[model samples]
Target: MTLTIEGFDHRRVPVADGVSLNAAVGGSGSPVVLLHGFPQTHLMWRHVAADLAADHTVIAPDLRGYGASDKPADPDGRAYSKRTMAADVVALARALGHERFALAGHDRGALVALRAGLDHPDTVTHLASLDVLPTLDMWDVMRGASAAVGFHLYLMAQPPGLPEQMISASADAFFGSFLDGWANDPAAIPSDVRAEYLKASREAVPSIVADYRASASVDVEHDTADREAGNRLQMPVTVLQQDWGAALGYDAAALWEAWAADLEHTTVTSGHFMAEESPAAVVKALRALMAR
Candidate 1:
């Protein structure tokens, strides 16, 4: 079955050089772009998007290299870097006549949103990240046994050939594990969305791994330079994450403080897919952040 969110108009919007993002746009008022995470599409915001659309223009897009978005091949893997992906979102919004927009992301999308804030502070009016730590803190807290549940991160961080090959061989099981495991209620995803996710992952193996590969290399370097230079998110930054720090023995909020000057850090009981598991909380947080 063809999966879609009601009240959203899907578009292949041009953004950055050599790329266009597949976005679902709806509603009016100030623009708000919602980005999807790994193993899922913008449909994850089905409930929240419509609600926000009543008050804001909601632009939900499959990040480059995922869903129906155009994936450009670039050497050195810089193309898939979060910095590049973030730029895609900013440009896409600008093309839609929004010079600045309220931006929110879940999981991998959060990483892209993080970069958008740093790289284009003037473009992103407010920033909300769901269920993820900033890249630097994420690597730091993955010490000792904290890395156990994040085996996929380690696997995809390796040199491309093997991870891509192995995952492609069993795409359904690989992606299904996260879709099932990370949700507070697995039924929140439903079966058709699950099938769409598996299909997208199967078709985009190399590009998907490239996104992760860039995270381990170029993405990290970009983040480190920003940190070393004492650069922080200039806007009101709200980070909504699962309490992985509690289980991993770290202060997730404190770690975020280092990167965000004006910060609202929160830990929710929902699993990794907080937007799906707890739409009301996600919507409330976003409305507050966008209020800034």
Candidate 2:
């Protein structure tokens, strides 16, 4: 059986025409939507969601083109762009009776949350991004040998057929490699959860590749346009990231300051999959962001 957040109720929320997100929602006071990263599902937010549900309405959903969410074909490439995915998130919240709420995301979801905060400032009251940089800055900073760490990014960024076919040929090995290598404590993600991630990713290879492909193309265009227009995240923002800058030769905080007026950036000791490996710290940071 698939594992779920203990007390949260699962439902399909229609965020767009013929597109419904599989969301696990619970708690009360204020709403906070949690987004998962690549090679994972909303289940990645299991621990954090349960704790936040104690005081906040936590909505954790499998992103469009991921997990159990509807995987619409990306014939136009715009289908999986962060702009479109951000709209899905806003629509999800409004459909759940929230006109304004805190938004948080890990990995790929972080990209979505950043876009949402930029595109719908009034709706996202607070924003938290776990372990990722905005699309444009991300591409800019990755260079030389350090760029090797993001080989998958370049691989998936290739035109449609090749990346999908390559990943699909050995889906488990491809997706499982990240789940194993990126975690500081592999045990943090138990066997069952790891299996779930691999299974979901294996089944959604094309859509997942499309999501990343968009990040390299259209997502970069959107962020570039926003930067040129001097558009920034209008809400309070909290960023928790590993000390990637120290090795990658970029000031993570300085880069983020360019986009957020109210910013709190911290370098976490946890690995890339911090949400699962360091839930207490993740929860603490999120609570602090919401309290701001």
Candidate 3:
């Protein structure tokens, strides 16, 4: 069975503390929440979500401050933290009558999914992460030549308003920059979809930067606390990463195991935008995770 974006019902659902989230939901069977990466909105999951909706109840939401979701100012950087974002998902699920569900996330969303599993393990039964390492390991692994693989990490981590202001100046180009740099074949992403990502990200510039900016500060602190507390994700985990080792000279699978105990990690031959670049692969991986 194939699902199309047109099949889903889109609505703004209230979550926590009077905050509301814009979500795209469809299909039936077990629920699976799809979370997208940075600089892209829930639109990133259009293809995969539709496919999964054929089998499972698929819920794709624009993270708290991105896409059409309310962009509450990140006063004190709390709104952008993964902990808060995870809570939004938890509340959104409960509101939708799903106290427990399968959760999958890519890029920034993957981080949120990770936090959700760790912080709220009883709620997330199965977890899938695409194209990212845990926050602390991701920060710790950069060394020498491999450092170039994630220069944006440092660029966005700068103190205060600089990164946010610079990115907001020409938000279209700033957000679209990853599309050009990360894809092995830029043509892999349909031009219309690419435009949609840039358009939504460009509009949500301040909140988007605040999301990345939190990764540099409080996110690190949270990851440190998790590490010290020895709270590894107890749920079944499936991680799909690009082969950064061959090009960047280090194994990514090893790094991921440090964070997840029951993990099945592998590298996809496609680009960083795995879901967009190769939807079939993403679908297969998710199907495997669902089976697990």
The most accurate candidate by TM-score is 2
Error of 2 at 214 (Å): 0.4
Please tell me which predicted candidate would have the highest lDDT against the true structure: 2
Candidate 3, clashing residue pairs? none
Better of 1 and 2 by lDDT: 2
For residues 1-292, what per-residue lDDT tens digits would candidate 1 score against the true structure? Answer: 7588897899998887778889999999999999999888888899899899998999999999998998777578799999999889988998889999989998899999999999998998899988888888888888777688889889999986899899989988999998988888887787888899898888888888899888889999999999999999999989887777667888988998999999998878888887877899999999999887
Those runs of model 2 whose alpha carbons end farther than 4 Å from true positions after fitting are none
- Model 3: residue 243 alpha-carbon error in angstroms: 1.2
Total residue pair clashes for candidate 2: 0
lDDT of 2 at 3: 80
Cα error, residue 287 of model 2, in Å, equals: 0.6
lDDT of each: 0.89, 0.95, 0.86
**lDDT ranking, high to low:** 2, 1, 3
